[model samples]
Each structure stands twice: as structure tokens, then as C-alpha cells.
Target: MGEKLLMKGNEVIAEAAIRAGCRHYFGYPITPQTELMHYMAKKMPKVGGVFLQAESEVSAINMVYGAASTGKRVLTSSSSPGISLKQEGISYASGAQLPAVIVNIMRGGPGLGGIQPSQSDYFQATKGGGHGDYHMIVLAPSSVQELYELTVDAFNLADKYRILTMILGDGILGQMMEVVNFRDEEKIETYDKSWAANGHKNEREHNTITSIHIDPAVLEQWNIGYQKKYQLITESEQRYELYNCDDAEIILVAYGSVARICKGAIKEAAAQGIKLGLIRPITLWPFPVKGIEKIIDIPKAFLTVEMSSGQMLEDVRLAVDGRKPVYFTGRMGGMIPTVKNIMDKVMEIKERHS
Candidate 1:
């Protein structure tokens, strides 16, 4: 353990990024996540970090593009609709293969929706919301501890792959307070940024950072290169946690706060002599398909619990691929499922399949 501190999830995320060596933060204020930017404004200057409150979400992400071009670790964050506005810059970052971290403290939305917590951004975050064939390393953290740890690692992951990484949290996690300890560890540089447009002062080649290629063939080959990197990430970056799944007749699949809710529900189910399990995907874009695949053919039913209208259920279905029955239960627009409601849904799935 390093030093223990009581902090809100959003504030911890900002501090963790700073500890992880990110010095540039560009973000616009949005509900449920404004605290993250607020924390940065308070601390970034003290740490000699650059904290710029851009005029809009669009401008903040582009500022991120600029900071990342020079190979400096940078971050930008927003809520749902604001995230949509950053999509274009995110895509450009992907095409340019720039390393940056984007935080999405999600809220309900198709247009300008509610300010309350919701996970409706599931598809947008994991499905390459921006244009072209590109991917962002997406991580979902369930608690304040994870919010801190994942934010720190998001920087490392973003730099390692030279691509955007998202710390995908919901409003509940953003607002909730918890005790977090920033563990002390030796700092070793993760990867090389030799391609950074830092400077040509030391008799080096002039490095250019761009996503555009005038020649179609060059762009096509560039896409091929990106696909190759994605393949490597897909192979090695999948993250998930299995809880009580060994003899679980029903396994709950969820992430973020929904996963924590399922944990409580599973406890109640166990008390009632029902075996319940959970598979929480920590890395959402790499989607833990292997984790689901390993549990396939286990003579069990897989039920996905979500705060959205079952966006992640599609991936669960694809992972199960008809081997076992897959069910979905969810609430929308910031409404959380009560523990009893979750237990009832579990019982319902058991009733249908049993």
C-alpha cells in the first residue's frame, strides 16, 4: 500500500492519471464527471501539469490530439452526449495511432438525455463509435479502487499500443466515495515513443503525425497495420473476473456498478440455496470473449444484467453461441435495479430453464 486517501471516484481517477505520469489534461465540463475536471484544475497546476478547460468537448479532444502528437501522456473526459462529440477526434487519434486516454462517465442518451448515471454508452464505447476501422482499449471499473487503478493503467495501455484507451465509468461510480490507496511501485517506462513529433533538435528525422493519406493504397495498408495491432491487443488485453461460477446454475454477466449490484444479488441467491455466479468484464472493448468461452458448455444459463437496455447482451449471446440459454435484465435512464429485482430476474431465468 502506498498512501490511503478518502476520495470520490472521479477525483481519484484524476489523481491516478497524474500519478501514472500524465501531465496534460484537456476536458470540458459535463454532469456526473465535472468533478474529474474540477480535481484536475485544483491539482494539475500544482503538479506542473497542464490542465486546460477547453471551450467545448470538441476543442478538448482536439487539444488532446495536439498533446498526444508530441508523445506526452494526456487525458480528456466527458459524459454521454459530450463523448459523442469527441468521437471524431477519437477516430482521428485512432487513425493517427496516437496514445491518449478518454474517460466517459456515462449517462442516459440517444440524443441529449438524462444527467443521471446509465451505461447506455456500451455500444458506442466498445463498438468503435467513431468512423473507419479502428478500436479503443476500453476499461470498465466497478469501484473507487478500480477507478483509480484502471485510470493509472489506462495511460500505460494507451502508450503501449499507441491508441486511445477509455476509462468507462457511469455516474454512480463517478459520484460515489470510497477509500483508495495508490500503491507504490517502481516506475519503468513502458514503451518507446520514437515516432513522437517532439523535436528534430538533436539531428533526428522530422517526425510527422497524421491520419490522412492521399493515396488510397497507402491508407489501405495503414488500416492493415492497425488491424494487426488490434489483433495483438485482442489476444493479450482481454480482462475479466469470475465470481462463484464453478457450480453456479446461473451466472450473471455485467460490468461497472451493475456488476457490484449483481454481487449483492448473488449473495442473496446463495442464501436461498441457489448457486449464482458472475463474470465482470474489466476490459470492455477486448470484451473478454475468451472468458465467456471458457465458461461455455457448463450446463448453465447466462443472464446479463445492465443499466442500459441490454447493449452488452449482444456480445454475451455471440459468445455463448446457442450453447446455453442467454437472458437479459436491465433498467434504463438512470434507474438502478434493486437487489430484490435482480434476485427476481435470476429466479425467473431459473424457472424458465429449469
Candidate 2:
């Protein structure tokens, strides 16, 4: 057990990763997530770890790929534009079945849009950002505590699945200060490097790490095998938090910082005699689709709120499968919607239904 201490989400992420036994971090500084890089730079060396600020996001991600190939727990952090640059490397990591952690403190973007918070990358992340028939395990953190916990979980899940794992956050979640209990140093397990590409010594054969396959059938088989792993993860690793749904007539679907704001609105709506509940998705890729579907049969409409132009709403619609109406409320370009605004929307939905 550990005592809770106040810490910024970005700093907590870096600290937690180190405590979780990650020894190598390669990242290029980007806004909103810069605190994460600074924290790593100052602390990694003290713990006999490596922290390198690469030339660009491209270089940083490739550096991470190299470290991950050696079966070393490695990490990278960036905002939207920088993350876009790392997409190619992220795809390679997935295809090569290398376990690594990448944190995207999402910012408004189609291309270099803004430095503020946004959930526009939901599709990019959940659907495989780079070109390929591949998927990364995407974890969404809605609080500073979750940021700390998910960073540790991201590393563990990546290694367990032999794939890249991403902690999807936003500017507010990255910058906010909250109480978090840091895990003990001894509680973390050291990774086994039997599969890692640490130079082939005597009695060991050369281990090559790559995604390139010349044979079509062989590549197809590899893709099929990876999909099976994804299916297993989807079944066993879905994460979400449900709030006050026992007698609810309406449900709010949100994630990251947006989900936290939705929680307040949900509470207020309940006070006003509007039966509202919240479904906050913690793991975005292995999305809590099945869990959400189970609640859809209760005869309630869903409001998908986000910091983007309805990116997550599509997922909600898919999960609901048209059993009920799914509405969308969003604000783009870094605007944070107020609790009153969300409550007002909930009221509108309630009035319409009534």
C-alpha cells in the first residue's frame, strides 16, 4: 500500500512508468504532454534509466521501437501533430509484435489544428492510426489517478499481448493535479528478454525483429494469428465505469476529461429528477461495446459527448445497434464544455422523451 500524494497527471504518468520498471523513454517534447517528457528527463537518469529527447517525433518513435525490440520497457509521449509523425513507427511496432507504451495527450487536429484538448483521434487510434491491418491496445484515462494506473497497465498489457499499447488522454487530463498512490518499487516485475533482440551470445541463435514478410500466405497467417490475440484481449480486457444506472432513463457516453465533466452533469441531472447515468470507457480500443450493449435494452436514449465532432458517437451507435436513439454533443478546437452545458443537453433529451 502507498499513501496518496497530489501530482499532475503527466508527471504521475512518468513517475508511475519508472516505478513500473520502465528503464528507457524516448520522446520529443510536445505541448500538453511536455510535462511528461520533462519529468522523465529529470527522473530517468536518477533511476539509472535512459531518457532521450530525439530530433523529432519520427526519430523518437523509432528510438522507442529499438528499445522495445531489446525487450526493454520503453515509452513515448506526444500531442496530436507529433503523434501523427509517429504513426509510421507505431504501425511498425504493431506489425513486429513489439511491446511498447505510447502516450497521446490529444490536441485538436486534422492537421496541426491546435494545442488544446480534443478527442478527434478516436477513430485514428481505435482503427489503427497508421496504414495496416493492425490495431494497438488503446487505454483512455479520465483522471490523474487513472493516468498513473493506466500507464502501468499499458506497459503490462503491451508486453502481455506483444503489441503497442497507448494511453489516450487529453490536455486537461494531462495538466490537472489530483491525488494518486504510487506503487512500491519492489511490486513491479522485471521483463523476461528471452524473445528480445539483445545481442545473440553463445548458445543463443540470432533473433531478428521485423514486420516485412515476402510470402503472401505467411503474412496472411500472421495477420490471422494477431487478430485472434486481439479477440482474446477484447473479451478479457474491456474496461469501463458505470454510474447510477439502476433506475436511469438516459445514459451519457464519454471518455477522458470529457467523461469526468459528464459525471458532474449526470449527478446534477439526477438531483433535478432526471434519471441519467454515465458510461465512461477506460479502454477505448477494446471498447466496452458488449458491456454497453447489455445496458441498451433498458429503453433509454444515449448522449455521446466528446471534445470532437462526434468521433465516439459512431462507436456508441454501433454498440446500440439502433435499439435506441443516440445523440451527439461536442465542442471542437480545444473548448471544454461546462457541466451546465452538458446538463442542459441532458435536460433537452429528457424533455423530448417525456
Candidate 3:
């Protein structure tokens, strides 16, 4: 425990990364996430950390790939379009098995969309934005407090699996302010980086880090090993929260800031005897299928809410596996789904089913 402080969401993520022993940051400025970079720029040098505002997102992600090769905790952040520019480097880092943290403060997008909040990048963050058959451990935070805590978790998970971890938040979460208790007294656990590219100093054989494998057999073998690692992560890392699901007729599936709105809708539905429950996914990559599996029989149907045109709906359907009907309601172009919208959709589903 430590003193609680009111902090902006983006700034707190930066501070939390610092507290978690992140010594390097490489990023380019972009809206809704520029404050995060600013905070890192201001505090990183003061704390003996390195912060570089790279020439571009592409350059920044490659720099992260380089720094992460040395086994130091490295981070980078960008909004939707900027993140798009970093895809190749992100793929490179994944190919090299580098442990790095990347944050996407999502904004409305399909190409230069508004700077307001949006979850349209759900597929990009969870389903491999970069080219390749790989996945990043994606953590979605619903509040400023969660923003602080999950940033630390992102770093730990990245190092634990030697894979990239993404803090997937929206513009609203990035700009909000709330009280957060910084875990200053908590000691961070360290992992062995025996595979790092740091010099051996003649005590051992020199280490090399590269993703290039020209031989098809070698690449196939490497991919097989990577798939095994991913399966392990998928089994161990599915995180979710169930609310009022013990006895409910409908289950609302959501993540990030949208989950907060779903909670409110649940309360209101309960008051009206509608019996709405919620499944809030904390880790979008693992998809929390187990959580859905546990309560699939309890709820008559599942309704997915998002800031995009049913991107997460596909995953929910696959998880439910036609055991129950799945429905979707979303608002795009910076429009947020309100409690009323959710309640209305619930009523429609109930009526049609009844």
C-alpha cells in the first residue's frame, strides 16, 4: 500500500511503468496518448531512464526491438494510425521473441477518424495487428486505476512469456482522471534473461538475437515451438470478471471502458427485474472463453457491446459455440454506447425471444 493520488490515466500508466522498473521508452507523439509520452519525457530522464521521441512510429518500434534485445524492459505507445505504422517492427519483435510493452490509446478509426474514444482496434490489438501468425497478450483497463495496475502487469507478462504485451485502452480511459494507489512498496520480481543479446564478456559464448531463418524446415520448427508457447499462455492467462451472473437471463459481454457502462446497465436492468449480468474481459487476447463457458448455460443469450461494428462478436460467438444466441450493438466514429442503448437492446432481445 502507498499514498493514493489523483492522476490522469496516461500519466499514471507512465508512472506505473517507471515504478515497475521500465528503464527505456521509445515512442512518437499522437493524440490521446501524447500526454503519456510527455510524462515519460519529463520523468524518464529524472529517474535515470531513457526516453526518446522517435522520428516516427516505425522508427520507435524498431528502437524498442533493439533495446529489448538487451533484455531491458522497454515500452512504446501510439494511437490507432500511429500503431498501424509500427506493425512491421512489431512483427519483427515478435519474430525475435523480444519482451516489450506496447500501449494503444485507441481513438475512432478506419483511417484518420476522430480523436474521441473507440474500440474499433479490438481486432488489431488482440488478433495480431502485425503480419504473422502470432498474438500479443492484450490487457484492457476500464478505469484510471486499472490503467495504472495493468501497465505493470503488461510488463511482467511480456517478460514472463518473452512476447509482446499490449495495454489496450480507449481515448476516454486515456484522458480520464481518478484516484490510484501507486504500489511503491511492492517489489517487482525479476526473470532470467539468459537468451539476451548482451555480451558474454568472455565468460560464456556470445549471444545473438535474430529472427531471420532462411530454411523452411527451421522456420516451421520455430513456429511450432512458438505455437506451443502461445497455447500455454492461452491456458494460463485468460482473465475476466463476472458480475451478477449467478442468476441472470442475459449476459453482457464487454471490455475496457465499455464494461463500466455495461455495469450501470446491469444495475438498472436488475431494478426492472430484467436480470442482466455481465462478463468483463480483463485480457482480450485470451478472450476469457472459460469465463463464458462457466455461465453459458445460466444466461438465455449473450449480448456483446463495443465501439465498433461487432469485432468482438465473432469471438463471443465462437466461444459460445451456438449454445446460445449472440447479439451485438455498437457505436462507431467516436460514438460511445450508453446504458440506455444497452438496456434498450436488452429489452428488444427479451421481447423477440419471449
lDDT tens digits, residue span 1-354, model 3: 687999899998999999889989999999989999999999999999999989999999999999999999999999999999999988888889999999999999899998999999999988898888888999999999999889998998999999999999999999999999876564676888999988898888889888889999999999998899999999999999999998889999999999999999998998898898899999999899999989999988899999999999999999999999999998998999999999989999999889
Evaluated with lDDT, which candidate comes out highest? 3
Clashing pairs in 3: none
Task: Write down the TM-score of every candidate.
Answer: 0.98, 0.97, 0.99
Model 1, residue 19: C-alpha shift (Å): 0.1
What is candidate 1's local distance difference test score?
A: 0.92
TM-score of 2: 0.97
Kindly indicate the candidate among 1 and 3 with the higher lDDT. Answer: 3
lDDT per model vs. reference: 0.92, 0.88, 0.93
Give the TM-score comparing model 3 with the true structure, all chains together. 0.99
Better of 1 and 2 by lDDT: 1
